[model samples]
Target: MKKRSSVLTLFLSVIMMLSLLSACAGNGNNAPDATNSGNKGSSNSGSELKKDTITALLPPVSANYQARFTDMEKEFNALYPHLTLKIEPASWEDMTQKLDTQVNAGSPPDIAWVGSTGISKYAALNVLIDLNAALSDEVKADYDEVAMKYFQLGNSQYGLPAYLAIHSIGGNKQFLEKAGIDWKNVQQNGWTYDQFRDAISKGVVKNDKGETTQYGFVFATSGVTSKDYLGIMAKSAGLPDYFDKNLKFSYTSKNFLGLLEAIRQMIDDGSMPKELSSIDAGKRWNMFLTGQTMITGKGLASFENSARLNNEKIKANDGSAVADSIEAEYIALPTPTFNGADYIPTAVVDGYIALRGKKDPSEEHIKNIGLAINFLSSGSIAANYSNELFLSPITESARNAAVLEQYPRNEENVKADQIMMSKAVPARTDIPTDLAAEALKIETEVIVPKLQALLANEISPQKMYDAVKAAAIKSFGEDGIVVD
Candidate 1:
């Protein structure tokens, strides 16, 4: 869920093609059909709800936020003719700062998109409205309980989970078959680290000159720091969370050494390229999509959407698209586990939150804002957003309306995605702000630079762990880290 600028660019490019395809397909307005818009809140009757305007801040769900939000607004207006909804598109990177500025100036938007981690912070600021008091029980009941928990603090519900983002390993089907691995089995279940190494090593091809003709795997590097890269993989190794609420830092623990060894072994055997530390994600992704590599780490569901978009362009003979688009399917698999470790993909949940504006509003206005939030966050409208973004719907209504046929999707990949989501757990969202900031500083300033040396094979994993531990202790004090 930590999206890079390049990924956003890719998403925008895909959205352009999606618009063209959907236009040709004639799926009018981009909102679910009235017959299919299951569980949208009851329409306002007679003069029960008075006319009011509510403003919202949302990120671009598609290429054009205006177009998408306009369609949603139209759909919402049909049910609540009296309420006028105005949506402002904000980039994910700038949303928090922008929202803070507005809230400080006593003019926060009625509703906005916020990371689940930020809900508690905003709730503490007294800027958030308790959603439990706002949304109807019928609507709230439809949301997945796991996702809903992120919005709850004590008795107040601060937000509604917008979507589920899962990160997993992706494989090329032809390469898996050539390597004598059953793609279906890998996709359905998962592989152990040893199995992963053996399979990828088998897939490697070398020329007569001893140069690798094709790599077995590629690691995505751009937009990821060393802490994130290792922390996510550590879960598959049955390691505890590296940083916990109790301020215990476990990155130096002995168990973590196994994860480092797995990566080094992968590289030492030539299953992964030595240049992994040098290349950015763009290069690695191109390698995977063009079949230069058989597998990729840090894979996203969005890649499938990208592949579909590329294929659509090829089918349409669009000169703007990549010529050698992926023909064989790209499928996702759960991360390779270590020991008897359970496979759990890293997940981040983002949600919609209603804010208390500068001035106390009338109850009717608050009611209107609640209705607007529910309209955008639940039911078929929410499903449409999830479909476009390749996100898991958090509401039962959205889930029921999530028909893959609505867009370009590989059924196998979709199945694998669902499996990953079922087992996925959210990142720690309750970390205190100051401590979180301190942890981030250590990650970027201390851990990442040494990680580069580790990736380049210039330092042993033990040395890398030791160096980071020393630096962390110096900053956090010896008593802070979990030495075990």
Candidate 2:
């Protein structure tokens, strides 16, 4: 997490703004415990019988985030008493640097929770096992196109989301009344680019001293998911993709360059903090919490978290119920659409979860992954995990009107999920599984740098796109790299 300025420390002011964004585990193949083999073990027909322990890796805890999985772990162990499931928590940084290491050593944990930052990298690397054979018919049937398609890679299903959420407009009715803005007017008029841009302009005000004391909308680094904040706009505009169909790097796409420029333009226009394009995500959110920033990209839980932090004064007219804990007030926004042939970037409701290997995968490992995945998706377990984790259900039953009414906090989330569901285009799942990460490195380490140069006015979007395309083709080939 990044540090924030003093303003984010406030409780009441937080309620004045916030419209923002958005856990889980299962065991994999290995034996319940791997370390204790020799003393009570015997070799079978001169073939060494090896045992492995099942574990899940995640980043360090941060306000209710890690708790989602830790809660699931407790329940999972209790339900399946014979399994010895262990959680290996560390900084996401550690997982980023160490995942390949453990996997290369042939001792990676059986199951793991991953986020956008690392999923593409690992999926390309093929460190995670193929999940196609393991998915139960019932489980496969339960998923909507978004979850089923998003985590796929080439021919394999490497991961699956627990749910789907969207990032969109958020507003506080009280703030609107005070500012003489019409809340009903905006929603009824529909969220157009012009309307959204104007709302922010109308909302911002500077005091006599030249300090902005109140802002109409807030979009900080914290206001959106760090993983694909820019990707959303690109999706809206119908660009190709930043990544290849295999979840690997294809950063040279016209789609990606176009999206990056939009984000850069937003920063340039002052709708977002100039520094926001540079700040880390946690720091950005902390700013929202303290009222340093108000309007944010609202996904599944941002509003909920904001509601928890705001005071009654802040909650005045926001539709969602975060008034008490959230220091700010907010309402769900219709996800803005792109003008071109694209859709909004599809975000997995579940960041990502996949089966890793203790060694090479086997029938036993496949069974464990299947059973764990099926049980995890079962409706009986869905309510606990979904509710506690603040997730949308992939199953239609969970999305049924009755269940949604029972969980009103989930209504905004569900609606956002619908937006993602309706507009999201499918991710191509055709890259060779093993090459996933080399592809990602091409995007992050290679393409992003070139893009920064291009966005700084040093080059054209076409030039940047072409350069990236050339490199990708040099590295991955035509079928492997699609630049649109």
Candidate 3:
């Protein structure tokens, strides 16, 4: 991870650059105009571009993802009538595996939107093309160089970043205020672990029978998985990730023990769901949206708009299944800092990458592929994707075109999200392949299940720590883990 100061400087410059670009564009209130595609610096003319069917693997960007993709295809086809797009939908969890399978079968998709972590993995496999060389300088120059730097391996640029994503918590302001807590203040000034625990515990409400009508907190293994959220909690609270800032394996530190203890304490106090271990991400989100939970873990900024849309549906009553709709206000909050540690939310840069595939695409095919990629990942199209997720647009043209069109945004939520972005360090992409692979193994095979057991109250924090340490030692050897 870069120094906090360096990260802040880069984010600030990105903001300044976006402001200048938007000011120059002069259409501040306009929605993204997908029809005006010719002006966005594509050197490929209609006559020069080759006609071919390009298949793409796309992850779900919203609940109405089918409609979103349909709209995208329409816009893209309108822009390039010669190119045909065959988009395949896949969940984020399954995309990497599906892509790998297709690539190994000697028939990979022409394009896939992948997370930052997958770039290095795929680049190592020699499956991706270098966007840095294929894309025009005008399009390339608009992106924040630091963000683009994450996708580069030596001289080969693996992909073009779509947006910078921050994963944090979302809260129901009504519940917090009912508990006499000022959530706006918490959004501006982050809370400590102890304060967060106290606030949530206080926020828990009971019915006349003393049953938990509203849970203070809830989490599931979707979006930000438990391992990532727990890891980020430890990191923001001054502990190291699986690897420390020095880039050495260091998950067994005492601070890690503290993180486990803090989580268990919340569970014991009845502030969080006791059956949290069994709940999936969909259930957790529904629980929060329907007012059964006061706060949700691993909340993405995009969910703020989801809550708004849900409320709108409830008002319209135009749907068949509007029984569970909620009208509550929501805001995103940074994962609480511990002691005096800096607020750093877990973050990643998502990208649109083109693959060479086994089809052995010709030079013109590759050029056409690059042109399609540039269109999907820049200007209005990229802005639309970013708007769906409420992420900061990485490309200047996207920034200029971005507007809050789909859903109403909470100003407080936007402000809090921006603050978290200023502090977030995109997960380090430079780990040695062998060590990185081992770390991933340890995470899935050991850390996640053990942490789940801890959340389920099946094991004490000490026992969970001990078990994880033993597994880490077995995988990484003593020299790799932090002895302290």
The best candidate by TM-score is 3
Model 3 lDDT per residue over 179-273, tens place: 88788888888888878888888878899999998888887753346566576677676663568766567777776787788888888899987
RMSD of each: 15.5, 18.2, 14.5
For each candidate, give its TM-score against the true structure: 0.74, 0.68, 0.82
What is candidate 1's TM-score against the reference?
A: 0.74
For residue 37, what is the lDDT in candidate 2? 14
- Which digits, one per residue and each the tens of the lDDT, describe model 1 over residues 48-125? 444678899987654434467787777777776666788998875577788889988889999988867566567656
Q: Report the CA-based lDDT of candidate 1 relative to the real structure.
A: 0.72
Candidate 2 segments exceeding 4 Å error: 1-52, 59-81, 91-95, 116-120, 175-190, 214-227, 243-261, 312-327, 334-345, 349-358, 377-381, 388-390, 396-420, 431-439, 447-484
TM-score of decoy 2: 0.68
Q: Each model's number of backbone clashes?
A: 0, 40, 0
Instruction: Report the lDDT tens digits of candidate 2 across residue range 372-394.
Output: 54444444445444554455566
**Pairs with backbone N, CA or C atoms under 3 Å apart (clashes), candidate 3:** none
Better of 2 and 3 by lDDT: 3
**lDDT, residue 302, candidate 2:** 45
Ordered from best to worst lDDT, the candidate numbers read 3, 1, 2
C-alpha displacement of 87 in model 3, angstroms? 1.5
